[model samples]
Target: MKAAREARSAAVVINAGSRRGAASTELAVDAMRRAGVPVRSVHPVKSGTELFQTLRRVVADGHDLVVVGGGDGTMTSAAGLLAGTDIMLGVLPLGTANDFARTLEIPGGLTEACAVIADGKVVDVDLGWANGEPFLNVASVGLSVGVTEALSPRLKRRIGSLAYGIATMQAYARHKPFRARLEFPEGDHEPMELEDVLQVAVGNGRHYGGGNIVSPMAGIDDHTLDIYAILAAPLREHVKIARLLKDGSFIEHDRVYHLATRRVRLVTEPPLSVNLDGEIAAVTPADFSVQRNAVHVIVPQSSNSASFEGPSRH
Candidate 1:
């Protein structure tokens, strides 16, 4: 199939704290100008509402593409607004994790990302929703949620992925699993009452939290969500799982349960914490579904040919 037209007029939105946001915007603007593509507007947003408003303004002004400069959170926020719309979404990876970009095989630097956008080649990608919010990468609950929530921005910037490692250690120290009832689209119900569950991750893209392949077999073009339930195991086993995840071998580990479905209902007894994309959304008893081909994304040709490995902990 022929790719969609590259936008001649684009709106660039950046999340200020994204590691490379400012530089990426500069690079993109320069590239667009070089290609003779007019930049309709540039918005640097501080909060989620501002981001949404900026997107609305850009769409209202008839901008053909929305180029986002930030990490997974910013991309996920933009995807929620532009999905099912004619406006194509382009990404400039400035965030720490940049999970969506990795899944699309978009290079890490701003210049390369700008070149991809200038080259066009838009394709439809699947999006996942948890309680009505769109998530382009992964939504996780349980231990991962607690760890991410407990982490401070200072820790993340100063130590990078090590922040997650520290937080994971702290969380595991207090680890306890609750009873959960999982309902699948096919009317099958599985009740799990365990003493230890590390986390449950629902993946729209194969990766999240700075390149962890939480769902190795996930495909963005496919209309399905890959689910992983990381059970609590011995500390040594957890260490082994973490190591395997880094090398893309965690999916086959004995402690992890993997499933793929379009919809899942999760009900937990004590209400576990939930993380959507990288941000905390809510506690348990959450409903999730996959919206097939819900958004048009600009991706490198390599993304279409690449296979994904499941997520791992840093």
Candidate 2:
């Protein structure tokens, strides 16, 4: 295994509320230690508020690396605090979906993930912003907000990734068409307005919605955001697009408008909720942009989703 130049001193934070978090907290620390990581501190948080405080505390403590465990929502919180800093992040995927971890090619198992953190290379990755709040995966409007609302903790813990499908079905039946105005500040594309839209999403990383590809060309280190808006269509056509979402071919359909840009301003007709990662964190008229190379993350050496810019690239 290649040696990482990042400091061995690290702190760990895990959201005990996540699906596998409570059971794996002790295991994660032990694995990291066994893998030769010099863990300095640990925090097991149970709520978003507690997580926020714990991350802030860890950042304030001046540790060179912080190992975070949880899903997309949990990782997003760490990103906001660690962005634009030298504090490297080690990931342990312990939540449902774990889309953020998937984008980085981090393994899902506890021991294997710790091995990556111990021996992986560090790289810079982009983060998406919504009204100044940082998000790791996708920030979405309309239908996704409904899906987030429908995805109760119980449902996720019981059925795992299948929860996304069941929640989508529930949200789909109650979905309402809305309108959105899109403007690109970089002048990459002309401003446009669309009506009867099912959802509008801006993706910072590739995989989301339990491993659904954002777009065929998407990458977390690409320094661009992938934007897409799905307009309502006839029943048969809508079903076809839905079937293609897993691989991001949904963007090829006429009803699905897609683009890649540095920044975009979205204005909704009635100011609907925005789901950032998995949390309802912002509301439209929200501004979305890519924070290029904003996070220093450790990934498996064999992973290619992001560029190897950290020490020990060879």
Best by lDDT: 2
Please give the clash total of every predicted structure, in order. Answer: 6, 0
In TM-score terms, candidate 1 sits at 0.90
Ten contiguous residues with the weakest lDDT in model 1: 305-314
Residue-level lDDT tens digits of model 1 in 1-314:
22424466778898877666655566678886676556778888777778778877877887778888887888888888777776778788887778788888899877777777777577777778888878888888887776876677677667766677788888778767766667786664454454456778888887777777865567786778888787877789888888876445687889888878888988777787778888887667888888776777777765672322222111
- Give the local distance difference test score of model 2: 0.90
TM-score of each: 0.90, 0.96
Sum up the clashes in candidate 2.
0
Residue 94 in candidate 2, Cα distance off native in Å: 0.5
lDDT of 1: 0.75
Give the top-scoring candidate (TM-score). 2
